[model samples]
Target: MQRPPRPSAPRRRMPSPGTGLTPLLLAALAFAITALLTLGAYNSARHVAQANLQNTFEYRSRDAHLALVRRMAVYEEVLRGVQGYLRGSVNISRKEFADYFSVLRLDESFPGIEALGIASIIPPGQLERHEQAVRREGYASYTVHPPGPRPVYTSVTHIEPFNGRNLRAFGFDMFSEPVRRAAMEAARDTGQAAVTGKVVLVQESGWDNKPGVLMYLPVYRAGLPAQTVEQRRAAIFGWVYSPFRMNDLMRGLLGEHSGEVELRIYDGAQPGAEDLLYLSPGTAPGRRPMFQRTDVIEMRGRPWTVVFSSTPALEAQRDTVRPLVIGLTGIGVGFLLGVVVWLLASERGRALKLAEKMTLELRQSYIRIEAEQRRMRVILQNAYDAFVASDAKGRITDWNIKATQLFGWTEREALGRPISDLLVPPDQRERHVRGFRRFANCGSGPVMSAPTEVTAQRNDGSLVQVEVAVAALPTPDGYGASAFVRDITPRKEAEERERQRQQRLDETREALQRAQKLEAVGKLTGGVAHDFNNLLHIISANVQLVLRSPNKQQQRLQSILDAVERGSKLSAQLLAFARRQPLHPQVVDTARLIERMDSLLHRAAGEGVELRHTVQPGLWNTLVDPNQLENVLLNLVINARDAIEGRGSITIALSNADLDGDALPDPEMAPGQYVLATVSDTGRGMAPEVMERAFEPFFTTKPEGKGTGLGLSMAHGFVKQSGGHIQLASEVGRGTTVSIYLPRCLREIAEGVMTPGR
Candidate 1:
C-alpha cells in the first residue's frame, strides 16, 4: 500500500563563490604564515650554524695555543737541564760547558730549536772579565756584543755547536734588548722559566729570515737564598736559554699544510698586523671566511693574542640546504591544505542540499509506511485463519482475535508470552524453540518450513492439530515471525479412516488371491487323482478276482496294500491343497514333538539309513496340526531313506527363526517369528528340473510305481493352509534340505502330545 506524496518545501539558495575566506584568500594567508615560520626556522638554523662554527674555531685555536705553549715549556726544560748540570759543579770550565751543551743534543732531541746558549749576568765592571772569560775558551773575537753601556749586561758566554749561525750569538749581550732583558729579569726575579716577545734573532742575516722567540731559565749559586726576588737577583749565576723560529715551531704543531681553520698568532695582547708573529696560509682567495674569534694565551710571562677564522673548506662542511627544503615543503603543504579546505566546504554545501531533498522523500516514505501499516492491521484483524506474530526470542508480539478464539486465549493474555509456552504441546516445545532459535540466530526462512502441521495445546490444556504457515518478519532489531494457523485435526482423522479402509481392501484382495491359488492346486490334484482312481480301480478289481485263488493270495493282498497306500497319499495331498482338511492347531513345542517321534523316525529311515534328530534349547513353540507335522516328518525320513539307497545319514533339525515378508522363501507367506524344522539328507539330490515339479501330484524321479510324488506336495499344501512356509534347497553333490517354517505361537504349550483324532 502507498500513501499520497508529501508537499514539497521551498528551495533555499546556495552561497556564491568568493564567500568569506575564499580559497585564494585562505591560500594566501596559509602561505604568509608558512613563509613567516619558514623564515624564522632559516634564521634559527643560520645562528646555530654560526655559533657552531665559532665554537669549532675556538677549539682548534685553543688546541694550537696549547701546542705552542707546550713546545715552549719543553724548550724551557732544556735550559733548566743545562742549569742543573752547572749546579753540580760551581766552577765549571768553558770546555766543560761546551761538552755539556753538546751532550744536550739540541738539534736531534729538540727539533725546531735554533740554538742553546748560556748568558752570564755581567756587571758593568765585570763586562771585560766576562768577555775575556768567554774568549779564553776559543772565541778570540768573543766580547760583550751590543757594546753600549747598560745598567746590567747579560752576555751569552757559551753557545753549543758554536759554528755557523750559532757562532753569531757566541758573545751577544741579550740584556741590551728590551724584550730579551725583560724575559731575563723575569726569570731572575721569579726564579722560573720565561719566554721573550717576538724578535729578530741576532743570528738572522739572510733574506729568508723568520721571527724568533727565546726561552730563558735563571741559574743561581749553589748555597744562595733564592726564594725572594732580591735573593734570586743577588744569587744569580747566569741564564740558560734556547731560541726558536716561529715558522718551524708552528709547522711542528699544525703540520705542513693549513687545515679547515686559519690560524694567526700575535706576540702581544694586541692582534695588530705589526705584532703578528705567525700567519697561516690564507683561505682560497675567492671564498671569504665565515667565522672568526680572538683568544689570549700566556706565553710564559707575556700574553699572545690568537685569532681563528673559518676557511673555505670549513664553510663547505656546513648544512645550508635544510632551510630551503623546509621553505619549499611549507609552500607545497599550504597549497594542498587550501585545496582540501575548498573541496570540503564545497562538499558540505552539496551535502546540505542533498539532506534537504532526502528529508522531503523521508517524510513521504513515513506517510506511505503509516498507510501500509493501517492496511496490514485491517487484514490481520479480519483474516480467515488465526494470525500470530512473535519476536526473535519466540515471544508473541501480536495476536488477532481469530488467534485468540482458536487458542482460547485473549490477545492481552497471549502477548509477551513465548509462542511455545502459549500454544505448543509439551512434547513439541523444544523442537519449536530450536526452530525459532535458528530463525533468530541465522536469519533463516520460515520456522516450520511453511504450511507444516503441528500438534498444539489450547489454553484449556486440550491438544489440537493445526496447519501452520510461518514466515520470517525482519525488523530493525532482529527477526520475528508471522504465521497463519488453521485447525487440521478433523482432516487428519478423515485421512486416517481412509487409510484404514484402503488397508482392509488390500488384505481382502490378498486373501482372495491366496484362495484362488489353492483352488488351482486343488483342481490340478483332483484331475490327476481322478485318472489315478481309474488305474487303482482296475488294480483293485484284478486283486479281488485274484483273491479267489489261494496260490497267489499273499501277492494279491500285497498289491492291494500298495494300491491303498497310493490312494490314501493322493487323497491326503488333494485335501491339503484344497485347504479342506481338518486341522487342530495348538501351541506345540517342536523340540518335544521331535523327542516323542525320535524312535518312530529312526524306524521309518530303515536299517541302512542313519536318522538324527537335533533340537535347539529354548526353541519357540509353534501352532500346527501335530499329527500332520508327524506325518510330514515321517514322509521326509522315508524319502531320505530311499534316496540314500544303501547307506547314508539323515538329519532333522529344529530351531527358532525370525522372518520378514522379504526374507520368507515363499512370497505368499506372511512375515513373523517362526519355529523352523529342517530335514537334510546325504543322498542323491534332485536336479533343478525335478525340484521344480517336486511338489506336483503324480510327478516322481523313482522307477515306475516307486513313488506317488505327493510327499512334499502334501507337506507344502498343509504348511501353507496352516499359515506357514515350505522351502526346498538342493545341490547335485551336497544333497537336499527341506525347511518348514511354522508361525510361532505366542501362548503356552499344550501339556501332552496329540496324534490322529485327538
Candidate 2:
C-alpha cells in the first residue's frame, strides 16, 4: 500500500504595522521598559557619585584636624625646651635667653606663636625681688603688672624675639587673667603642657585683636620630684609659655592647601561666637556649606571641635565624569534594545500566522495517513496466505503473523534471516539459492513471477509442500522481493497416499501370484519330505543292519546319511518361509534372551568385527518362540559379519516400543506395544534393488554355497506368524539396520505348539 502525500500549509501575510493594534502595544511596552531602566541607571550613578564626594570631604576634614593638632604640638615642644632651659640654671641673663630664642628661628620654623617667654611663680613676699630682677635684665621700667595682692604670682619675666609685640608681653601678670591663670595652674599642678582657651593675647595689636591662645609648661626647681600633684605644686618655680593668634596658627598649619576645604576651629566642643577660635579665609561669612565633617581633637587636656566643610567649588573638583557617561550610555542602550525587541515581535507575529496554517494542513494529512494504515492492517491480518518481504540480499525484513503460523517461526525469529535458508528444505536449499541469485541479477526466475509447488521446512524440521508466488519489489536503490505462500501439505499428502495405494495394489497382485506358486511348491515339498522321512527311517535301520552284517558298501552308505541330513535342514528352511512350520510360542523377555546370546553373537561376528549389545531397562516380554528369536539374531549377525569385508562393528539393541496406527514401521503390522530388537552393522550396505528383495527366499548376493538368503525370509515368517513386524533400512555408503518388533504378551498361552496360519 502507498501512503497518501501530505498537504502543505497556505501562507498568510502579516498585517502592516500601522494597521494593527499589536505594533502599538509593543511600542508602548518598549518605551515603558526603557524609561524604567534609564531612571534606575541615573539614580544608581547619582548615589555612587555623591558617596565619592562625601568621602573626599571627610578626608580633607581629617587632614585639617591633624594639621591643627600637629601645629599645636610644635608650639608646646618650643615651650618645653624653654622651660628646660630656665629650670637648668639658678640665674638667667637677657643675652643668654636671646641666644636661646635666636637658635629657634621661631618666625620661619614655628609660625602662629607670637612670642615665647617665661613667667616666674613669685610669692607676695618675693614680688619686689622678682620685679627688680626683671628690670635689671630689660628696661628699667619693667615691673610685674596688675599688682593685686595674692598668695602667688605668675609674672612674665623674659621674652623674645624682642620685637614690639614681645615688649608688650614682657612683665605681664599672666596668672591675673582667668584664661591664662587656669592654664598656668593646670600646668603647675599636673606638670604637663597646658593651653588657654579663646584668650586675647596681651601682645596683640589693636588693629589685629583676634582671639588667641596661650600654652604653658611648668618648670620646677632643680632636684625636686614632680610625680604627684602636691609635689608638682610645691616644686613649681616658673612657667615657659607661648602666645598664639588662632587665625595665624591655622594659616601657618594649612599653608597653600588651606583653600581646598573651609575650616572652623572652636575653642571647646560647643561652637559659639565667644568661643570661636578660627575660620579659613575662603569661607563665606555666615553661610553653611554643601558638605561638612567635624572632628574633636584633644589639645592640652581640652576638646577642640574642628569643623571642615566642602564648598561648591570643592565638590566640582571631585570626579563626576564616569557617572555622567554611564547614565547617557545606559539610556542609549536601553532604547536600542527595546527597538530590537519590537522588531522581533513583529516578525514572530508573521511566523505565528504561517504556523497556524501549516498546523491545519498537517492535521488533515495525519487523518488520511491513519486511514490508509488501518486498511493495510486489515488486509494483512485477515488474509489466509503468509506475506513476507526481504531485501535484495535475501535477508527477511518483514513478516506477518500468518508467516509465523505457516513456518512455525515467530516474526522475531524470522526477520533478518536469509529467507531461502530459513524456509527451503536441505535438499532444495541449493536450488532455492540459485533461484534467488538469478532473481537478484535479472529480476526474474523460473520460480519467480509464477506460482509453484515447493517443499519448505518448519521449525520442527518437518517438510511441508506449499504453493508460493514471488514478485520483485521495486525500490529506489534496486529491487527487493516479496512472497505470498499458502500451505498445501494436506492436499499433497492426499495425492501421495493415492500414489502409494496404486503401487501397493500392483505389488499385492504380484505377491499373491508368488504366494500361489510357493504354496504349491511347499505342498509338493511337504509330501516328498514326509515320504522321504519314512524312507530315511527304513534306510537307517537297514544301514545299521548292514553295518552289523559287515557289508562292503558301508562307507558309501555313511556319505548317503550325511547328504540326507543336509536335505532335511534345507526342507525345514523352505517350510519356515512358506508359513507352514510349527512354532513353540511363549511370553519371553527379549532383552534377557539377547543378553544370553551376546557371546554367541560375538563369536558369529568373527575376529574382524566388533560386536556390542544394548538392552534397554524395563523392556516388555514378547510372545514369540525364544529359540526362533535366537535364530533370528544369529542369522542377522552372521549376515552382518559377511557384509563387512574388513574391520567393522555390529550393534544389537533391545528396547520397548509403542507404535500408533499411522506411524507403524510396517504396514502389515498391527499398532500396539512391542519390544524391538535392532541389529545394525557398519559395513558395506545394499543397493535399493537388493534391499527391496532382501526377504525373498533363496535370493543370495554371495557365491553359490556361501548363503541361503532364506535367513531373512525365515525370520520374517516367524515374526509375522507371531503377530509382530520385521523391517530393514540401508544406505549404500552408510550401513545396514534390521529391526524386529515383536508384540508384547499380556498372558502366557497354554498351547505348547502352534502351526502358523492355523
After superposition on all CA atoms, how large is the RMSD of candidate 1? 55.8
Candidate 2 positional error at 578, Å: 99
Candidate 1 lDDT for residue 83: 56
lDDT of 1 by residue, 694-757 (tens): 8876567888668766677788888988888888999886789999988888888545645333
Candidate 1 local Cα displacement, residue 400, angstroms: 99
Using lDDT, give the best candidate's number. Answer: 1
Worst 10 residues of 1 by lDDT: 442-451
On TM-score, the candidate that comes out on top is 2
Look at candidate 2 and give me any clashing residue pairs. Answer: none
Identify the runs in model 2 with alpha carbons over 4 angstroms from their true place. 1-28, 87-90, 318-758
